[model samples]
Target: MYKVFFRICRYPHVVIGLVNITTGEKGYWWFSILHEEMLCEEYHVKNLKGVLLDELPQNGGWFDYNDINRI
Candidate 1:
């Protein structure tokens, strides 16, 4: 079990990204503006390294994916 934290653009806080290496599953929590709370969503990826290198596109805007910290 591995957890990675990322700070996406426009959001003031960090989002928690979860990874299960054994199952090759990934997830993360984000603040849903409409719902006004945090929500979790699953991502299909091999590992954290893949997520950083391939899965998330580095767009220079509010949707930009930026790695902050991890645990």
Candidate 2:
């Protein structure tokens, strides 16, 4: 299973950060909250929580590929 960290952006937009606990791989993506459940299902992410905006990198996208690698 994967552990996902997320933060709500403007309106329906959500920034999602994922860590593959077993492989130590990480990634980030964004989508509407309306599809959050679907994302969890597809990713097999059973654990998820909200994070402070400050916890993320200061990038144009709120986060970047390199930031996720550090997470």
Candidate 3:
């Protein structure tokens, strides 16, 4: 599984959630107080960049593609 970055319509650096992608399944993980997770489809997601969850900042912001490659 991997963490997929997503930017809202107006906020470019903020990560609204993550997409957990596996062999043939994907799920959405909304990072919030409620901490929700749901199964979703690839097309249902947009503006995504694959990144390892461990490399992400706790505050949630932009991550360099190079960092992803290093993992």
lDDT of each: 0.37, 0.51, 0.37
Task: Write the residue-wise lDDT of candidate 1 on 1-71 in tens digits.
Answer: 44444434235543445455556566654432322121222344422233432233222212223433431
Clashes, model 3: 0
- What does each candidate score in C-alpha RMSD? 10.4, 9.7, 12.7
Whole-model lDDT, model 1: 0.37
Instruction: Find the candidate with the highest TM-score and give its number.
Output: 2
Summarize candidate 2's per-residue lDDT along 1-71 as a digit string, tens digits: 44555444444655667566677676676555556555446546643363222223323243574544343
lDDT of candidate 3 over 1-71, digit per residue (tens): 45765533222223344544554334333232221111123224333445444433344343343343232
Pick by lDDT: which candidate is best? 2
- TM-score (C-alpha, index-matched) for candidate 1: 0.28
TM-score of 3: 0.27
Of candidates 3 and 2, the better by TM-score: 2
Where does candidate 3 stray beyond 4 Å?
20-48, 60-71
Superposed model 1: Cα runs more than 4 Å off: 3-12, 30-71
In model 3, pairs of residues that clash are: none
Error of 3 at 20 (Å): 4.1
